[model samples]
Every structure is written in C-alpha cells, then in structure tokens.
Target: MLFIQRFVEFAHAFPEAPAIVDASSELSYGELYKQAQRLVEVIESTSSGSMIGVLMEKSVDYITSVLAIHLSGRTVVSLDRNYPVERLRQMVTSIDLSLCLLNEQEYDELNVMLDQGIRSLRIDKPTAPSADNDSVEIKPETLEEIPAYVVFTSGTTGQPKPVMVPYRSLSTLIDWMLKAPGRAGTTLLYAAQGFDVSFQEIYSALCYGDRLLVITDEQKKDMHELTREMVSAAVTRLFLPTSMLIPFVTFNLHDSQVLDDLQEVICAGEQLKINPVVRQWFKAHPQCQLINHYGPAETHVVMEHRLSSEPEDWPDLPPIGKITQASTAFLLDDHLQPVLQGNIGQLYIAGRSLALGYYGMSAQTAEKFVTHPQTYERMYNTGDICVLNEQALFEYKGRRDRQYKIRGYRVELKEIEIVVADSELVEDCLVVARQFGRTTTLVLYFTAQDRDQDLSMRLHTHLTTRLPDYMLPSFYKKISAIPLTPNGKVDLQKLPEVGGLRSLISTSYVEPHGELETTVCELAACCFGLDRLGANDNFMDVGANSITLISLLAELRYVLAYDFRQTDLFEYPTPRLLCATYQRSLDTTQQGAPTVVPASSRKQRLIAIQRFQEKKGG
Candidate 1:
C-alpha cells in the first residue's frame, strides 16, 4: 500500500490520535489530514509540474507542505533553508522547479534571492476545503512508480546531484516498519530537514499511527535539553546519527532516567562503534535496543544490526548485519564478479530499495547504476568497501572514493576543492578530512597568489555564502605549495599535518591572566586539541563546533560549580571576554550582589582547575 493511503486510513480510524507534536502545538490525525488536504488544493492550483520545491525550516508547515505535495501527485524537492542560497539556487535550477512552497519569512527572502521566474507561494493557514471538492483518487500502482521525492547529495563534479526516489522505495521500508513487532511507539523527528532519515521518522511513525515529536534546532544542539524534551514528550523511538552517539550517551550517564522511556535507538550515517560510554548506556537501559543501520541516499536503510547481546560483550565496531527485506546487497570485486565470503569488496544494492536514478543526469547515472551481465538486474554501486563476516553480516571497511560522511552528511573532498578553486582567493587548494578521535573535520590547504592576513575570514565568508556549514572546512592552512607526486597527482601522504593553534587563531598570542582566564584557556585548548590557547582567540574561529563546545561546557560546569548554558559560549566566545565578564560578576558579588559562584567553592575550584591545566599542559 502507498504511505499516503495508509496515512489516510489511520486519519479516519483514529481522528483524535496525536500525529505530530512540536514546541508550539500538537496536530491530531484529523486536524493534520484537514490541513494537508487544504494545502493540496493550493498546491494543485499553483503548479502543474510534478516537481515542487519546499524551502523552509523544519516545522509544522514544512511537514504539511510535504504531505500536500504528495497528495497533489507531485515530487518534493527539499531545499534546506540552512543551506547556502547559492547552493539552493543551483538545486532549484537543476530540477527546474516551476513552483516552490515556503514559509512566509522565507517566501519573502527567497523570492528576491532565488530565480524570480520560479513562482513562489507562502504556506499559510490552510483553510477548509470547498464543499464540492472531492478527494483526488490515486492508483497505488501508478503512485508506486512515480518519483516520491528528489534529494540532493554531494557530487564529484562540484555541483550537487539530485537523486529521484520512487514511492516503492519508501513503501518497502514503511511496510517493514509496520510489520515489525514491538517497534510501534512515539518517534522523534530528529534528523535535519533534507536528511533521508527525516522521511523515515515522519512516514514510518505517522503511517503506523504513532505520534511524531518534532525537535527544534536549539534543542537538537544541547544534549541536556534534548534529553529533557524527549523525556517530557515520552519519545520512545529515536533516529540518531552515529556521530552523536557517544556524546548523547555520555551526557545522560548520571541521569539515566531520561533514557528510561526510549525503546529503540536507530543509528546511521557512519560506522557504529560501541565505545565505553555507549556500552554503559545500553547496560543501564537493557530494555532499549541499539540498531545500526547502513545505506546511501540512493537506497535508504538497506541493512541493520540489533545489538541483542550483553553490552559488555559488544565489539568496538559492530557489523552492519543482514540485508533488510526491502533491499538486496552484493559484495562484488573490481570486475563486477561476486566476491568470496570474508573478502572485502565494493557493495552494490538492488531490489525495491533502488532509486529511479540521478535526476536529469543519465550519463552519470549509468556510471554508478549498472546492469548485471549475469542476471540483467539493476543495482546502485554504493562505493563502500565491505566484507561478509562468518555470521553472514556485512562488516564496513571504508569508502572506495574520496567521499566521507561528516556529522551524518555525505561530503566529497573534490567538490570542496572545486568550490575553493573557483573562488579565486587561492592559486591552488586541496581539501582533506582529518580525524580527531570520533570527530572528522574538513581542513583546506591552499596557496594564494598573494596571501592576505585576513584570508581565513575571507574564505569563511565566501564559503559560508556558497556552501553549507557541514561542507565548510574547520581549519584553513595557507600552504606555500601543494605537494605533488612524480606523476603530478597530489601526494596524499606528503601533505603536512595540520598543527599549531596559530594557523586558526586570528588573534595574536596573549597569555591568560587570573585563575578564571587560565582555566578557560586550559579547557578550551584541551577540547580543541591544541597545546595552548590565547585569551583573545574566539572559540568558533579556532574550530569549536557544537560537540566540542558541549564537551567544554561540561568541563567548565564541573570545575566552576556553576551552570553554564550553550548560549553563554556564544555570548562570550573568547576566553578573555568570558573570564572578564565572570570576574565582574564576582566583583558585584563582593558588593552584596547574588553570586553565581560561592567564594568557598571558588577557592576549591581554582585548585582543581590548576591541576587540570598542569596535567594537560604537561
């Protein structure tokens, strides 16, 4: 059955059952259906084209717009508002969207920024449908073959490639979720707007008649607030990216009750490593299951491994497990022949999980999606190296290409290099992914014709305006020349290791004064993987992301004996600004003001902070 049909059935069967919940309001099945139906009318009236662009932030209206587009028999082209306008415009032109549905704020801003030829309509309060208007009847067979949506992924040619997913591809996964026992529960829509898992969260839950909780951007960044929100909403199922697994589990170690109601945690986008903190999380919450899912955008979630054994016995890198019912995976050698078991080979996926193809890129599609000579079956070349274990489960090795998954987003190093080279700020450039423990950061090495002192800021601003934050390099190195091998190809091994705080730190080195400034510098340096930190150096300018900032916050709270918010890090980004502000607060405390840090605890914390600095600085 089509997902839309199943959604309609549930809406009729359980009118008042909660369908979607966000910070502002809750939409019951009946209300949600009415809203979607009303918007369907607006969608049909606006565009005769099958492809419609959805440019908005994650919200109730965004969800409603997606449903309405499907109901109107159109394909949704997700144009993430967080993405750079240049990137969005590229996608808009690539797909040739005739109409775009957007929030009022974005409708106004994008109308001026985007292609003016493309019609834009603001998604407002959907009104009651006309009395004479009848439901649009859609044949399941016809709908199954039609393109459900088009998602853009990073391409090697520097432009984003749009992959058209058919309804059958999604229906297969949704059907599996429906049939799976004990999986029905309230799920959280935690994935980003354009991520493939967002569809899984929205369709699987709603089609199964389970409530779907929407997490805000602010809540998603703060683990403590995210846990609290999940607990309050009674969210039983979560789709988390593997990159955040350790941090999320570690943040709730002492307060395990926040995870009590969670029955399932499906992790994807990278290899799942059962670290100490993750194993402990599972040990404390045995009732909850940890599932590692693996798939590319061309095929959404083709394999899953459920960790059923004791957490203590779990391997560091768990296998991706058996092929899902929706898809069939084959390990093939360079000659496209099937590899023997236990031998590493490139993975190729077939069956119902395969997408239609890359939109309007027939030549590129043929290059990746090939026809098997033996069986004449079509399969997508995943470009992922994997080996079959004795248990018949697939063990992920690494990528066959330069592509890397950073924070759940697929990144192509060549694309970043192309964009940088095109900017003309650099004579030549190379982009590489550098691993710092669990985090993988993009680092750009460039040689400019005449290096500017403000080159880093210029690159940041230029890249921010053309690419998404995830694609931007965390560190920029002004190299004298890019090393080349005898054959003239860039030598990967010869590239200098990104070192020293001076490369990223914009401010001149300034020694930290006072216990507070010293403590801040020490903690910042440790989290940022630097030997030392300057007092006036900005945290973000020195490559502090949300995950690192949270780690720094946790340490500061423990030593300072005061609750610090993520916002505090943003307000006082530099160590000097932060410490000076806190010192003034302490000064006010001396003048009979309420003190956030008690004098007694301040002295004790000073000793602990000094010990930490000594241990780390040593």
Candidate 2:
C-alpha cells in the first residue's frame, strides 16, 4: 500500500495516538490528518502545476504540506530551507514549479530570495476543524508509475539532477523497513528535510504506528543536547548518516545506559567503517543493533546488513548485505554481463524499487537507467564498485565516478570543478575529495592567472555564491600548474599533501602563553591537520566542521579529563577563546572543590607542556 494510504488508515484506527512530536509541540494522528486535509483542499484549488514545491523549514507543518501535495495528486519538490538562495533558485527554475507551500516565517524570509512572481501559499491551520476523514487512495497499479516526489542530487554537468521517484519505490522500501527487526517504537526523524532519508524516517514511523520524534537543527548539532533529547524521548530507532554516527558513538555512548531505549541504529549515506570507537560502543550496548544500509538516490535502500553479533567479531568494513526483497541487484562488468561471483563489478538494481528516472534530463536518465539485454527489465546502473564475499553478500569497494558523500550529502567533484573553472579567478583547477580523520572534505587545487596572495580568499568567496556549503572545498591550494598524465588527464597522485601547505587563513601567528592555552592549541592543531596553529586562528577558516568539532570534543575530554560540552566549541570556536572558556569552567569547579585531572591526562599534559617548552627553547 502507498504510505499516504497507510497513514490515512493509521489515523482512522488510532486518532488520538501521537504521530509527530517536536521540541515545542506534539500532534496526534487525528490532528495531523485534519490539518493535512485542510491543506489538501487548499492545494487542489490553487490551480498549480503537477509539481508542487515545499519551501518551509523542517517542522510538523512542512510534513503536513508534503502529505497534502501527495493527497492532491502533485509531486513534491522540497526546497531545503538552509540552502543558499542562489542554489534554491536553480532548483525552482529547473522544474515546472507552479506553486510553493510555505509557512508564515519562511514566506517572509524567502519571498524576495525566490524568483519573482512565483506563486506561493501560506500554511496555516484552519480556525474551524475539519469533520471529513475521507481518504485519497490511488489504485496500486496506477500508483506504481505515478511520480510521488523529486530528490535533487549532484550532477556531473554542474547542475543538480532531479531524480523522479514514484510511489511504488518508497512503498517498497518502507514495507521492508516495517518488517525489519527492532525497528519498532519511537523513531527519531533527524535527517535533513530535503534528503530522501527523511521520507523513510517519516513514513516508516507514522505509517507503521510508531511515534516520530522530530529533532531540531540545534539539538542535532549539540551532542549533549541530542543525547538528552534521545534519552528523554526514549527513541528506539535511529537513522544516522555514517559521518555523524562515528563521532556520536565516540563521544556520547560511553555511558552504556545513556540511551537505554535505543534498540536499533541504521547508518547510511557513506561507507560504514567499524572503527575502534564504534566497536567499543556496541560492546557497551550489547542489545542495540547496528545496520549498514547502502543505496543511491535513484534507489532508496537496495541492500542492508544488520550486525547483532558481538562487537569483537564484526568486520572493519562490513558488507552491504543481500539485496532487499523489494529489489533485485546484479553485479555486472563493462559489457553489462554478469560478472563471476568473486570478481568486483558495478552494481545494477532493477525492481519495483527503481525510480522513474531523472526529471527534464532524458538523455542523462537513459544513460543511468538502462534496459538489461537478456531480462529486458529496467535497471539503474549504480556507479558503485562491489564484490561478492564468501557469504555471497555484496561488499562495497568504492565509487566508479568522481562523486563523494560529504556529511551524508552526495557531491560530484566535477560539478565543483566546473564552477571553479568558470569563476575566471583560475586558469585551470581540479577538485578532489579526501578522507581526513574519518571526515570527508573537498580540497581544490588550482593555478590562478594572477597568483595574487589573496586569490584563495577571493576564490572562496566566488564559489560560495554559486555552490552550497557542502560543495565548497575545505582547503584551497594554489599550484603552479595542473598536473596531467600522458593522456592529458588530471593525475590525482601528483597533488601535494594539503597538510604540508601554508595556513589558508591569513591571520598572523601568535604563540601560546600559558599551559592551558598551549594544551588546547596542541589538541586543536591535532584535530585539524596543522603542524602549528595560532591562538587566534578561526576553526571555520581551518576546515573545522561539526564532525571535526565532535572529534575535538572527544579528544579534549580524554586528554583534559574535563567534561567539555558541545556548546562550548560552538560558542568559542578559536583556540584562545576555547582555552579561556575552559579556564573559567576550571575556576568555577575549583572554588567549590578542585576537579582532579586523571593520572593519565596529567601525564599527557606534562608531555604537551614539555613540547611547548622545547619549541620555545628552539
């Protein structure tokens, strides 16, 4: 059944049951249904095209708008509320966006940012409650082919490709999700609104009669607050991207019982690496299951591997597991023929779970989604390279294209290179994605026309206008010329190491004064790949992101033996400010009772202090 149809049934069966809960409010199934019905009436009367854009911030109302559009037989094109206005404009213009659904706040904030004369409607709950409980149902056969929504992914051609997903695709994935073990109880909706995973979190919960807890962006950033919210809400199922999962477990799950109700955790969006921290986390919470899911935007979730065994036995790189029952996956070579069982091959998926194809890019779509020669079934050629293991399960090797997942968002390096090359600031450029301390970051190496000292800063400012934050390179390197091989292709191996380059920030270096400042600076330098860092160097300017900040927090707690909060890093991003904040915390703790540093931490501090003194002597 379609998730919308199932949601309607759930509402009628349990009207008073809680459906959505956020920080400020809770909406029962009955209230949610009533609001959606009212919104549906408004949507149907708007005379908009088939594609309806949802531009509201992540909230219950935003979800209501999505459901209303589906009920009105329109496709939802979610405009990420946090996306830059320039990027948002590209999405709106690319599709036949006839109407945008927004709340009062977004309507005011984004009115001028969006295209002029674009029609929009404000989402407000009706003063009079709706008495109708009528359900909008489409026949199964027809619904399978109808477009439900469009998800925008990075395109190799310097634009975001809209993947048109039909109702059957999502229904197939959600059906498998509901039947999955330990997926019951309250599920946290932590994914960004624009991503397809949010659909899984929403439909899998409400459609299956599980409570959906919507965490705010602020809470999602702060590890301490996120943990408190999870414990308080008793979230049983968590869907975290692999990038966030690493630091979350490393820093937050030390207390085995912090999230006593967490029974299942699913990680996707990036390759899962079972590091030591993750192993220790699972060892502490033996009852919680860790699942690794793998798929592209073209197919929601084609394969998943669940680990319920002891953490000690888990592989460092777990297999993506057998294909889900909803879809069939094949390992094919360059000839599109099935590869031998043990050989690495590209994965091709074909089944009810396949999407309709890319919107407005038929050629690109045909290139990706092709018909099998013998079977004649439509299959999506996933650029993922994989090999079958001893158990005949698919093990992810790497990507065949220049695409990379940064903080769970798929980015095509070619797209960024095209933008940078067009900036007129550089004669030629190449962008590469690299894994730095468990975090994936983009690094751009370019040869500029003028080679001015401020070219890196100028290029950085130019890219921000055209690309989103995730697509921007974390570090910029000014090379004399682009490295090329005999075939005239960019040679990635020739690029210099980003760590050995001069500081990207132009701030003058200031040596640390005291022991606390020196220790903090050393840890900060270690977190970011810098040999030496000034006290005033901004973390943001040095490629410090939320993931790195979490890693730094874990390092700080371990080395300082102080319970450093996530908010402290945000409030004081620089090394000097952070050290000052730490000193204040220490002073407060000392006035009442001295907080003893651990013996191990004392030894580490002694080492850091000794290193600082030696540098001074030199």
Candidate 3:
C-alpha cells in the first residue's frame, strides 16, 4: 500500500488525534487531511504526470504539500528553501519540472528564479474549488505505480543527482519502522526537509498513529532549547544523525533527566562508533534503546542494530546488523560473486525498497544499478565496503569510493574540488575528510601561482554560492605545488598536514610563556585526556565537550581562584588565549594598571613566578 493510503486510513480512524505538532500550533489528522485535499485540488488544476517541487521549511504546509503531491499521483521533489537560488534553479531544470508547490512567501521569489514555463502554486494559502472544478480521481493502482518522492544527493561530477523513490519502497520502509522495537507514542521530525530520513519520520508517525512533533529551525539551532522542547512535548522516539546524537547524549549525561520521555534513539547518516563517552551514556540510561540504522537514500533503512544493554567492552565500531525482511544485502567481490564470510567486499542490495534509479541520468543510473546475470534481478551497487562476522551481521569497513559522510550528510570530495576549481584564484585543489575525535571536517589543499594572503578567504566566499555549508571545507591550505607519483597521479599521502594551520577558531598561534600559561596548558591537557597539548591545539579538535569544559572550569576555579564563565572556553579555546584573557581580567581587577609587563621588571617577574609555584605546591 502507498504511504498516502495509510495516512488516509489513519485520518479516518483517528480524526481528532494530533497529527503534527510544531512550535506555534498543532494540526489534527482531520485538519491535516483536509489541507492535503485542498492542495490536491490545486495540483489537479495546474499540472498532470509531472514532478512537483515542495520548497518550504519544516511546517504544516510543507507536510501538506508532500501528502498532496503523493495523493495526486505525482512525484514530490523536495527542495531545501535554505539552498541558494542558483542551486535550486539547477535542480528544477535538471528534473524538468513544470510546476512547484511552495509556501506563499516564497512564491514571488521562486517564480522569478525558475523558468517562465514552470508555474508556482502557494500550498500554504487556503484555496477552494471553483464551481466548474471537477474532482480529480486517482486509482490506488496508479498511485502504486508512480514514484513517491525524489531526493538529491551530492554527485562526483559536481551536479546534484536525484534519486527516484517509488511508493512501494516507501510503504515497505514505513511497515518495517512500525514493527521495529521501541515504537513509542510520539516521534520527532528533526531532519532537514530534503533528507530521505525525513520521509521515514513523517510516514512512520502517521502510519503507526503516533503524534508527530516537528522541530522548528530556531529551536534546532540551540541544543538546550531543543532539549527542553523534547521534554515538554514528551517526544519518545527520535531519529538523529550521529553528529547531533553525540551532543544530545552529552547533554543527557550532564543532567541525566533532560529527556525522560525519550524511549528510542535511532542514529544514522554515518558510521556509528562507540566511544567511551557514548558507552558510558548508554550505561547510565539503560532504559533508552540505542539503535544504529544503516541505509542509503537509494534504499531506505535496510539494516539496523539495537543495543538494549551496555556491553562490558564496546567494539570500535557498531555492526550494521542483519538485513530486514523488506530487503536483502549481498557482499560481492570485484567479480560480482558473493564473498565468503569474514572477507571484505562491496555491498549490493536487491529488494522491493530499491529506488527507481537516478532521475534523468540514464548512464549514471546504469552504472550503479546492475542486473544479476543469472538471477535476472536488478541490484544497486551500494559502494559501501563491508564484511560479515561470525554472527552474520554486516560490519561496515569504509566506502569503496570517494564519497563520504560529513555530519550525517553524504558528501563527495570531488564535488568540493569541482566547485573550488571553478574559482579563478584556484590553480588546482584536492579535498579530503579529516577526523578529529568523533567529528569529521573537510580540509582542502590548493596550489596557485600567486599566494595572496586573502586567496583562501576569497575562494571560500565564492564556493558558498555553489555548495551547501556542509560541503564547504573547514580548513584551507595553500601549497606551492601538488606532489605527483611516478604514474603522474596525485600523491595524496605525501601532502603536508594541516595541524598547525589557522583553523576556524584563531588566525594565528602564540606559545605559552608565563607561569599562568603553563598551568592553563596542563589543565587543558588533563581535561582533554591528552598527555601533552600545544598552546595552539584547538579544544574541539581534541574531543572537548560541554561536560569536559564544565569540569575544566571548575578545576581552574579551585586551583588558581579563577572564575571564568563556561562561554570563555568556547570564545578563547586555545591555552594562549585563555591565559591572555585571564591576565587581562587580573589587570582589570587591579584598577586598570599597565596592561603590559615592563621588561625592566625581570627580578619582579621571577619573584611572582616563585610565589605562584609555592602556592601550587602548598
């Protein structure tokens, strides 16, 4: 059955039940159904047999447009309203879109940006059927045949590639989610509108007759505010990318009762690595089930692993677990033959949940979607390297291609290189993912004839127009030349490290010199669990979290009688900055005395250092 049909069934069964709860308002299933029907009427009047783009924020109107497009027997193409206008225009042109459904405020702007032939309808505004308007009827069989939605992923060629997901695949995903363990009374929709996982959050809640809480962008930006909303709304089931889950778990660990209603926490978008902090979090909250969900946009949620109890010794990385009944996964070697257990191979998936293929890219689609020679079944080459363990669970090794996930979003390194190459300032560039503890950041290396001081900044501003913020490299390093191998290929291994370069925090580094500087450096190293730390080492790069920062602040207060706010660690992350700021504070307390120490006071400086050391020894 189609997801829309299930929504219709639920609406009729529980009309007064709350279907969607946003920050400002709540919509019942009855009201949601009526609004969707009104949107269907608009679609029937303006277009037929074409994909409809829903460009809006996460709100009731956005949800209404999605349901309306599916109910009207057309595919829904999700367009992030936050994306640049040029990027949205490219997606529209690539999909050959003739009509787009948007909120009222975006109608004028999008109409001006899109081609003249394509029409924009305001789904947010209420519309009534005219006297001459005829009811458009779509058979259930026809709805089953049409694609449900289209989601775009980063392409190696620098263009956004769309994946056509059919209704059957979506239905299968929803069915599996309904049967999954820890099914709660309320599910939170926190993913971005354009992400495929958002569909799972929307449909699973409606299909299972659970309350759906839609998080607003304002609340999502602040973790403390978002946690309060979750507690107030009693959000029981949540799906978050691993990047977000780390902070959420950190918050829960600090309070231990921030999200008492959360029953199930599902993490996806990247590989799940169980760190010591995460393991400790699970042990503290044994009541909450932690699930590692693994899938691509081409096939939604094929494998999941659930841990109800904390293990004595956590694995380096979590297993993806057995394949669900809705789909099948095979680990095939280079020859497309199934690999034996305990051997590494590329993953190929075949099932009813497989996507229809990449939209409007036949050659690319053919390369990825291949048919089995003997079985005659179409399968998707997932490009993921995996191995089956003794228990037959798939353990994720790494990607077989250049594509990698940053903050739970699939990103292609070549895509960043392509955008960077477009800049006139760049001669050649290479982008690579750098891991700092649990966080992954993109670093770019470029070689240019002229090394202007502001060249990196200029290129960064230019790439923002062509790519999303996640695709932007966190650090840029300028090189005189790119090293090459004997085969004339780029020698990525020989590239210089970006460790000491200016990062997002500070423009330059200054070594610690004074006694206070030395003490702060030692304290920072102890807080971050490192034997030694440089004066320039970033706090975030060394796996510092809110809990660590709090502990460090408490220690500083006790040891040196320093009262620094928690925000100080974030604003002044490096030891040099922290020491300098503390000295400034001390000077201010001393009635604005000379800020700089006199060079002539060498004996006085030595005496002060001696007194400070004696105080510490006491």
Q: 1-618 in candidate 2: lDDT tens per residue?
A: 787888888898989988888877899998888888888777777756888888876788888888888777678888887777878888888887888888887877678777775788887634345447576554666666778889899998988898999998998888887644443489898888779998888888988788888877878877778888899989989999987776688666447788878988999998887755678788888779999998899998989899878898988778999899879999999999999989999999999899999889999999999999999999999899999988989998888789888988999998898888888888888888876545777899988767666588888888888787778888888999888899998888998878423254557888877766777777676556566677887878778877778777876765666778877777887888988877788787767533335556656644643453343221
TM-score of every candidate = 0.89, 0.92, 0.83
Estimate, for each residue in 106-125, the C-alpha lDDT of model 3 and write its tens digit: 77788778889888887656
Candidate 3: deviation at residue 39, Å? 1.6
Clashes of each: 0, 0, 0
Query: Which candidate tops TM-score?
Result: 2
lDDT of each: 0.81, 0.81, 0.76
**Residue clash pairs of candidate 3:** none
Error of 2 at 557 (Å): 3.8
Cα RMSD, each candidate: 4.4, 4.3, 8.1
Model 1: residues with Cα > 4 Å off, grouped in runs: 125-129, 132-135, 179-184, 451-454, 499-523, 531-537, 554-562, 575-618
